[model samples]
Target: MRDLYQRLRITPEAEAAEIAAAIERCQHTALKADAATVLQAEWRRAEYDALHDTLSDIGRLRARLGLTHAPYWRAGPADDFSLPPGPPGSRFEEWMQRLNRAARAHNRWRRLRLGWWLATLWLATLAGGVALGHFVLP
Candidate 1:
């Protein structure tokens, strides 16, 4: 009869409560009360089940609970969504490369600054020694 997925704005994988809420949420807009009858009316539910037997467990539960269905199923398995390791130039690798570049640049700058200060101090000492020898030695 009616495509429950479209009528309820849910996937076949949706739980009983999810389907009920979807139908309820769309009642005024896209959902027709007749469409939700499958969840409420036993005859309508049988018709829906007979028409679509391949529904997932959640779908069957939705049919049994009718429109009054509240979410009975527990949350599905938790997913970490973590990706496997990648090759070079990937996100992690790129971040590491940037960090290394910053460290190297900072070290080079420190060495250059230290060398400049040491050279300046050496020149001042040599000039002082020369002045002392020229004036005091004579």
Candidate 2:
């Protein structure tokens, strides 16, 4: 028999339609009552976690785009209202400014670390290839 978690995995995005289908499948299947109960609990937990994760992503995007305040709901405006640019070096600016001085410093550190590891691997492979060639040549 398929595990309850496997059944729960069928439901994606916690959509009502998908979840409903999963619940129906679970109810019709002749699975052990304990396993089914455990799985139903996990399904709700996963749904809650998925919702929290989505909300966090939305909040991050809003922060990155400098939408700290909600837009005013105008009944009928004569002109279009566009938001102005945010302050320099703020959250939005930090998210926008690629390769900034601070970011450059961190990137340089990362490159150095990667380069060191890559050089070590390259030397090891070169040594191994030379040893094999020497043994196989003669």
Candidate 3:
């Protein structure tokens, strides 16, 4: 599979249809049946297996985290679960809830980071254009 990926110049993130298209393009371009092709075949198989495993793991983790329930998993307030009070000052459940909250915070931070990058790029481009216009108009 590694060989195939190289011949097609594709990554694991490429969709199956994209990979197939890439292979077809490579075939039309006269790629050879060689060791590279063998490696690419292996890589593609591994990528698919890895994706499947990761998705499975995420599903299991969500279930364990009680995210499968409505409120936490969905946008509606009706689906939310109230935190269960732990027995007699034991902080186990509270600690777990804190960890979950932290994870969500981290995820939100990542999303905001991406948004900021995009907004900055856009503003820079707009400012550049305004400066260019000023120069041209004068």
Candidate 4:
């Protein structure tokens, strides 16, 4: 059995060259091992374990905060999740702004819809009253 870092063939604080080499090594090793099996390896170092647990804690924190996805998990062509390149909280604030704007727009639309229904009912009642008065009186 191999630790998580061992399964991934990466070391803590690995240099770029080491990371590249380790990635290649892991790909080769991954061929013979199932992902589940590889990930089941016991921790070889306490520090790696702590780092993994910290990531897990962040996942829990995101869930507790009602976030659907973690902002730091960039899955782009040029992925850089190790450390965020942009200013901290900028991406989160952007996402929050987007959500708030959408919510505000939806609320406006909902109010408009409710207003339309109320106006239609009022017009229908007024027309009914006028028709009744015309039929009943001179």
What lDDT does candidate 4 reach at residue 107? Answer: 100
Q: State the lDDT of candidate 2 residue by residue for 1-138, as single tens digits.
A: 233334355533465556555666555455435334533476755664565456556646655567654355322121112233345566766655753877888989999999999999999999999999999999
TM-score per prediction, in order, is 0.38, 0.28, 0.32, 0.42
Query: 13-96, model 4: which lDDT tens digit per residue?
Result: 555456455555664555325423433344433444576667656655554444443555445312211333334455566787
- The count of residue-pair clashes in candidate 2 stands at 0
lDDT of 3 by residue, 8-102 (tens): 67764677677666665665343534423433476746764575456556555554444454545454332222232334435545667899999
**Winner on lDDT (1 vs 3):** 1
Q: Model 1, 14-97: lDDT tens per residue?
A: 766886778777745433576566665667666676656644443544334332223452232111111224444556556668
Off by over 4 Å in 1: 1-13, 17-81
lDDT of 4: 0.56
Q: Which structure among the candidates has the greatest TM-score?
A: 4
Off by over 4 Å in 4: 1-3, 6-86
Q: Rank the candidates by lDDT, best first.
A: 1, 3, 4, 2
Number of the top candidate by lDDT?
Answer: 1
Alpha carbon lDDT of each predicted model: 0.60, 0.56, 0.58, 0.56
Ranking by TM-score: 4, 1, 3, 2
Better of 1 and 4 by lDDT: 1
lDDT of 4 at 130: 100
Distance from true location, Cα of 65 in model 2, Å: 18
Model 2 reaches what TM-score against the true structure? 0.28
